[model samples]
Target: MEYTSRHTDGKRINTRSARRPCFLPGRIEGYGTKLQRDIDGKKTWNDFFFHVVAPPAMLDHGVWPDSPTGYRAANEEYCGHMMRLTRALFEHLSLGLGLEKGAMAEAFGGDELVFLQKINFYPPCPQPELTLGVAPHTDMSTLTVLVPNEVQGLQVFRDGHWYDVKHVPDALIVHIGDQIEASMNELEPN
Candidate 1:
């Protein structure tokens, strides 16, 4: 849980708390699938058919992946771990901004913080160039952590150019969203 010097300038900070365990059971109450993306008649959305899930849909017995027998347990476990990592990352970022460890979490809604995951499954495609996985836009959440496959797809816009971020194995990409930007603006000195 230590924030590396690369993310911080020579400052090593551990954002995890002893009270927070590795796996949380009841914390994720429920899981649900928000959509089964198949808008265009091509069967999938440019090789990427997306599905979103949240707690409410799960508890209400919403559409879930029925084919994968052991998906519920696995997805639950993955979400739990990601939540923990996100909390730690938020705290570490808070420390980076010279605020209390819980400051960012508090700003992000504390205990009521919602974590909705949008999973984009990119199947094998013959014409890869003619598809759009996701349109060019900014995320609206406080933060977003992307766990992508070996495929190099993510790009960052800079200086009138789009630069593809090289894929590194076992790496999680984190992006600060608009809410974080709004929070930073709020913190800006007069």
Candidate 2:
């Protein structure tokens, strides 16, 4: 079967139309389907992307593809590893803030925490300068851990300019999300 991206209405998603809510449980999102355009109606870098969202419960239940040889085993292993790493990172960050080691974890729903992983794929663009792979925006999760490909297209806005993020082998780049930033502000409100 062809693995094509389709919308909840059974319509194929493309780069032309605006985003709509995806009601299908395990649907793959099409390019630019989950992003808003700029003031000039220009699509973000998301136009070159497609992704699958897998919730923790879904992963636990093995609701993943199994026919692609070792794909199932590899995905499960990766998910388990990422979850452990997330837990460790939370504990360290909590301790660094002078709170109890499990404070962050507890605040984030603890053992029953719902983790969502988005596996994004960005294809090659004909005119790379015209569109972005993903728009510049802060992540909405409690924390985001990104394992980027070796293409080196990731950039970070700093000091009034965007800087390329260097890729390190076997390294994961973590970002504190809006929720954590809000919590930090509450901890030390100016």
- TM-score per prediction, in order, is 0.68, 0.71
| Cα deviation of 159, candidate 1, in Å | 1.3
Clashes of 1: 1
Worst 10 residues of 1 by lDDT: 42-51
Q: Which ten residues in a row have the lowest lDDT in candidate 2?
A: 15-24
What lDDT is reached at residue 134 by model 2?
A: 70
- Model 1's alpha-carbon lDDT is 0.61
TM-score of 2: 0.71
The Cα error of candidate 2 at residue 182, in Å, is 1.1
Regions more than 4 Å wrong, model 2: 1-42, 45-63, 66-69, 185-190
Q: How displaced is residue 89 in candidate 1, in Å?
A: 0.6
lDDT of the candidates, in the order given:
0.61, 0.63
Tens-digit lDDT track for model 1 on 5-112? Answer: 222563322333344232235443222121233344332322111223344343322334443577667877887898899999988998888888888888777876
Top candidate by lDDT: 2
* 1-190: candidate 2 lDDT, tens digit per residue: 0134445573344433233323346554433343345534544534333333344443432234334568556766887888899999998988888878888888877887767666565544445666666767888888999987788778888899999999999888999998888777554211
